[model samples]
Target: MHYRVAVTGLGIVNPFDGEGEPNSGGVTDFFQRITNGQSAVSLYETQDIPRPISVPAVRCAAFRPELRLGKALSTMMERFAQLGVAAAFDAWQDAGLDKEYCQASGMTEASGVAWGTALGGLMAFERGYRDFWQHGRERVPPMSVVLGMNNAAAGHISIQLGLGNSALTYSVACASAATAIGEAFQHIRNGRAKLMVAGGSDATLAYAVVRAWEALKVLSPGDKATAPQACRPFHPERAGLVLGEGAAALVLEDWDHAVARNARIYAEIAGYGANADHMHLVRPDQNGQVAAMNMALNEAGLSPSELGYVNAHGTATREGDPIEIAALRTVFGRHAEQLAVSATKSAHGHLMGATGAVEALLTVLALHYDTLPPTAHLDRVDASCAGVAHVRGTALRGSKVTSALSNSFAFGGSNAVLAFKAVR
Candidate 1:
């Protein structure tokens, strides 16, 4: 029998702060900021590049993993792993499975960790390379290799949580986290595990990462001197994406298991679909995107008209946004006009591999609360991307949302789409 998956808890570490600002700390604060159209994109300075260019980025400047994680472990972890561990801790606590309590109950072995990241421990990797090549250091830190691996975050989560089931990592570019969460949901659905910590993390603000993006010429222009609304998705004057760093984790449990435990169910993981385009390295294909969405809707037993909202992968790039709109229109037909399409990246900046996990959590929260976050900075819709119900200006509240989808179209032609439904 095919089992169902339930989202029991969520935790996040984004550029958002609870200091009456746009930074999202947790689920509630994140929803509030997005609904308020607050932009977290700001000018950040880094020595990763030669001249230290000022680029628009979203960073968790306030996150002190030491306060949450112990000093020793915190120091050993790189920024991405730290964010992942912090989010995992919050998720574990939120799910009412305290670390000590879980160990006491002997449930650690039944749990697993599945995470994703595009560039793992990027900051440390850059530093280590610099030290070895430029500074000619005799020896690097012992933990440098451990921290530089793409599976480092997953390994850390498994160790910290004492999970022995399995620890898996996906590196499918931007769709990484969504793929992880989807696979974790399948693990629970197949009765392989009763619970899992699933998410994605990336801290790619290093000089090499930024310089690579700059070379692609897909990054938006403007520094500290410009306004926060630099990356405007679907706007007529849209520039490009602003990369950010963050982590998000969701606690997925079996439906019957969660219900038996009397746990709070935020939403149900109804369906998941992923496919690849063997076409281009960077440019997205409408056919591939449509296939992904259709597969998800089909698996969820949902029609295009039944899909209330879509957390679009609107990276604000001219080539990407219009193609996404075309795919939606083709799949949803006339229903596309009634759909609440919102590109939240306009406010939070693109979190690379971690983006899908963040958006998936937000989508589940949206379905639970019946509130759709707006696409910030959508001043004038581009003529090519029009004809859809783009939620702008304010959050669409009190809408009867039965199901929603989060779309992640990454580089390397990977497309992952996850479907969520209200826990009715």
Candidate 2:
């Protein structure tokens, strides 16, 4: 018998409230910001770059892990690891599983952690290189290795939360976090665990990191003046994605187990699909995207017409938005025109590896509240993208939205789609 997975809790830290500050108000605050068309993207002065070029990107203004994990533990963690642990702590607490309760219930040994990231500790790695190689420093930070490791976030969460079973990390470019959450759902569905902390985090706001993206020519060219309107997904004059930093975690529990514990269920992970393009590394393949969506719908036992909303992986790049729209049209046919689709990246900016998880949480909120977050700054949809129903201007309300899908396609052609259904 396959166990059903229920989302029991959620925690997130995004640049939604400005720089470095956690969305302390949690999902409620995030939803409000998205619906209000507020954007997190901003023009930041680069310190590591050769010239004084201002790049548009998302940076957290503050991160106060000391409030939750104490100063000692917080100091040991890099930014990404700290974000992961903080999100996990919020999820754990929200799931109603405190230290005493977990000890008594033997939950410490029954659960695990599965996290994701494209670049583990980019800042740490860049700093280590600068200190040891470029600057000819005698020694680097002792904890640099721990901070830069790909598995650091998952490892930190496991150790801090006493999850004894496993601590797995996925690094599939943009698909990382969605795949992590999908695997966590599988762990519960397959009876290997009762609960898990599943999500992704990335803290790659270093000067080198931003410069590297600029070299690829895929970043937005928003100077300090046009930061708010920089990322316009599917819009006629869309430029490119603005990188952001964030961590988002969800508590996935067995449905029956959650009910037994009187836990509040946010939604159900009805289906998940992940695959590779086997095509060009940077160029997206419509066939790959369509296949992933079909796989998810098939696994969910859902027809194309049953899908009410879709959280698009809209990066606002001219090439990406059209390709994504074409794929959606191919998969859903005429029904695609009626689907309430939106890309929150236009507001929150692209969180890279953590993007999938962050958007998944937003998708959950959309389904839970029956409200559709708009694609901010989209004054006019691109002609190629106009065939579909784009939620723009204001949040669409009172829609009978029951099921939705969050799509994530990555650099190396890794694609992941997760299907979520309302519990009611």
Candidate 3:
């Protein structure tokens, strides 16, 4: 017996209200700011390195985990785990799954957590390196191993939520979160679990991580004045991606379980498709992208024309944007021209492993409210990326979006696509 997955709640800890502000208003406020074209990207500078470095980045500067998770719990986890636990708590509360209720209903053994993080505990490791190499220390902290592990977030979340079923983590670069969510959906759909907390978080603003990305020449260059417009997806003068630090999570429950509990359903996860390019280690393959998308549509029992919107994995890189558009053209054919597509990364910046979860949340909200967020800073669409109906400048409201796809294509040839249908 196949089960259906329902997204009952959402949470985020991003720079959605622009830089330096806490996301106090939660997901609704995030949707409002992003759809209004408010960018969180800003000029980031740090003198921690030998030489001063400046670049555009989105940082959740005001995210205080202590205030949300308490001081004792906050101090035990690294930045990524802190962000992940806070977001998970928010999602749990949003789903109406409090500790008392979970204990009363005997949900401990049926619930689980699946999280993603590309650079897990990067900040802690960086700090350890600074202490050892820069300060000439003999050894690092003993707890560094537990705090710096990739599965730390999932482990903490499972413990906090009393989830005894599973605690899985994925580190698939940019598609990590989407893969986690997709796998969790599969687990629930196959009757392996009844409830799952699925999402990702990354806090990789460390000096070394920034320098490594800088070495790739893909970090968008900008000054204070141009920082807000640095990431222009599908634009003629699009530079490249802006790195970000954030977390996002969703509570996915079995459809029947959600209904029985009177939980509010935002959208139904129709299908998830995951595949590999097997063509390049860095460069994306259009054929692979097309196949991944087709697999999702097939699993969802949806025609190409039925997909009303697409949350594109647009990194604003010259080669990547055009190839993604080409794949969409091939998959949707003439209907590609009618598909409402936008890359919300333009406003929130790219959160690496956490980006897929952020974009997935935005896609769910778009379908829930029938409003499509726009690609900020897109003054003129690039000639090669002009085939689709781009949502730009401001949010497109009342489009009656019924079904949508969230695309997350990562390096190393990993591609994951999720299909969502609005609950009528």
For each candidate in the order shown, give its overall lDDT on alpha carbons: 0.89, 0.87, 0.92
The most accurate candidate by TM-score is: 3
Which candidate gets the maximum lDDT versus the true structure? Answer: 3
TM-score of 2: 0.96
Go through the candidates in order and give the clash count of each. 4, 6, 0
Model 2 spans with C-alpha error above 4 angstroms: 17-23
Residue-level error in angstroms, candidate 1, position 357: 0.7
What's the CA error at residue 68 for candidate 1, in Å?
Answer: 1.6
**TM-score, one value per model:** 0.96, 0.96, 0.98
Error of 2 at 258 (Å): 0.3
Per-model C-alpha RMSD: 1.8, 1.7, 1.3
Give per-residue CA lDDT, model 3, range 1-424, as digits (tens). Answer: 8899999989888775334344466888889999999999999998775878799999988788888799999888999999888888888899988856556889888889999899999787888999998999998888898889999999999988889889999999999999999999998999999999999999878899899999999889999999999999999999899999999999999999999999999999989999999999989999999998998898888999999999999999999999999999999999999999999999999999899999999999999999999999887999999899999898999998899999999999999999999997
lDDT of 3 at 109: 83
Candidate 1 has a TM-score of 0.96
